[model samples]
Target: MPYQKLTAKELLALGNAAPEVNDSSWCVTWDPSEEGSAAERLVLDTLPPVLDFHTSGSTGPSRCWRRTRETAWLEAGMLAEFVGAGTPHAPGAVVAFAPPLHVYGALATFLVPARLGVPVWYRKEYVGALPETGQRRALVVATPWIFSLLLRHLDWVRSFEHLTVLYSSAMLPSDAGTLLEQAGPGRVTLVELLGSTETGGIAVRRWEGGESPVWTLFPDVTRVDGDAPGDEGAVPLVIRSPRLGHRPGEPQPAEWHTGDLVEPLDDRTFRLVGRIGRLVKVNGRRVNLDETEHRLRARLHCADLALVPVSDPMIGEHVDFYVVPALDTRADELDLSPVLALLGARPRRVHVVPAISRSALGKLRPQQTP
Candidate 1:
């Protein structure tokens, strides 16, 4: 369905007119408003404190998560306060290129504007281009892929005189960040948010050329070292955030152990190493999936690729490559010798596909091999 975009003033008017809900399912609709009809507001305001959000499952299995509405609103309020500071007095519209149903988009794009009383717009599909919001300022809520797409059409991006882009779901490569700043002579600011379905906005870092590749934790969130062993003897990162949710019957955890291994630069900043889950034994040696992918990326011409591990009785686990080749290139014809040399072992196999499957955020999804 085509997403509906409306100004904040228009949405507020609709909500003021009639916010009534009669549906027992708690889902309400607004036929003609981005904020939804009064009925939708009623549902939102009256529903239980709990909200169900599903993970993108980019790394593994997709799981349904339940979080308190309070947590969501708190994050929204924080986003508004943070983004509002740099916005013009008129308040620029929030432009999101992500699915509103997703957690990141829901909080940052939708709820943030709602908190700020600002107009917001959502792009329902990948258009590979951004509309020119003349004169007025804009806060772009998008994923890495959207920014990657924007890089291709930097000329169009210059149209926006003032813009701040929020990138999430995956890490924005340093090179990509460079291209963004170089793109469009106009003013552009990049804010990278690091979090997941389990943890709300944990930390954020503003990307500038030559700055340390470390993330600064949000004031409300704190991190501590953990004993959990991760890939390459890395330690898991433990976090305590008010925005995190707790399951029923379980005591509130003092700290949440993020399976991600990080290098602590100090009390407030850290560098993400990789996910421990990606660690696998190949030829009886530990191999980090992220490291392998990085090595392969340096050697390959493809822009999008994923390295998945498959069980092997002999080697314990064997790597498989799934890649999306450039238009003029053939994925099958690509040499595997470099990849083999990187792993110091041969992959179980390599598959050339039309494109690497991923969520809107450029996070690789688990592929089903034929």
Candidate 2:
């Protein structure tokens, strides 16, 4: 059936405030007004909070995480306040190297900028391609690796008056973050976000002179130690945040158990220690699944691959590589020997497939072997 048995009220709940039959399919009609783009505003407003963003697969295997629009907006507000971006009078713009589809990228690039009514520029090559910020507040969205790489071109933007460099995807390397040169003509603050796709914004750390050890929670978020610390004396953090990505009409837990291991601190703060749950022993040695996968990705220059830890009673565990070889590259032609040699472990077997399926955020999706 082209149309479901639903009333106009039901259609309204489904985002059609005014449902009309153009010919065969139902279409939403909006009242024409100059207050805003009525159609765009209505669409964005009526959207249900339920959405699936994929985890970064850093601490564990990749999975599709259901995030909410409410969470996004809440975090955007928090970010706005943190970056001192409420005033629309200031000339401002956003420049990003991160993909907007990911949670971090979406917040830093689109959501925050859109709220502040500032222009956004996405550059595939950001080394020397930043637009000049003439007395305007500018936010630079980047990953740790890219931020480190961008250090070489610091002098390129010496004229920027106000710049905030926000980076995610792991902590910035100590050497790269040890000092912030004062050559630039502005307060070059550095901000780092610590959170997961499942739980929106957890805590944030900001440093201006140099890297700071203190990580502060958002004004509304709170965290506590889990019931008990798990392996390696790693403490699990339980948090309550108004910015968590949650679905409506579902029974919700009063507090959320974040999978990342953290050190116990006061209510409004905590230090991220490490990741647990996904660590496995291979060849009687500890191996991090995320680290192994990332190392191999950089080594092979391939993004579509995963490492699966299979159990063997005697050997503890072993890795199996599932990869989607690059175009025109044969399965047997790819090499993992040189990389594995440094790791002191090897995959029991490698699976060559036609594709490495991923979600919008580059999280790995399940693949079947032919």
Candidate number achieving the greatest TM-score relative to the actual structure: 1
C-alpha lDDT (0 to 100) for residue 61 of candidate 1: 82
lDDT of 2 by residue, 1-370 (tens): 1322333223325431122311123211122241134423533575565655566654457566555665665676677666666554232666666665567765665456555555455554434444543445677776644554456556544455667777666435432343256434244777777777767777888777643567787778787668888656657877887666544455445678877776656667666654564467666676666666655655674436776666666676776778887876777788867457745876777787776555433344444463
Worst 10 residues of 2 by lDDT: 21-30
Q: Model 1, 1-370: lDDT tens per residue?
A: 3344444433333331132210110111123333324423533565446766677887678776667766776686666655654446223566666555567866765566666444555554556345544435667787766765667666655666656777777645544555556764436667778788777788887654445456889889988779666655456889998777655545546778877788788889888876766777778777778767766776878756777878877656788877777777776667667777877787787777776777756676776452
Best prediction by lDDT: 1
Q: In candidate 1, which residue pairs clash? A: 8-119, 18-38, 19-38, 20-38, 20-39
Off by over 4 Å in 2: 1-72, 84-91, 96-106, 114-117, 122-137, 143-162, 168-190, 207-215, 265-268, 292-306, 322-338, 351-356, 366-370
Write down the TM-score of every candidate: 0.77, 0.61
**Candidate 1: what lDDT?**
0.64
**Which 10 consecutive positions of candidate 1 have the poorest summed lDDT?**
20-29
> lDDT scores for all predictions?
0.64, 0.58
Q: Model 2, 219: alpha-carbon shift in Å?
A: 2.7
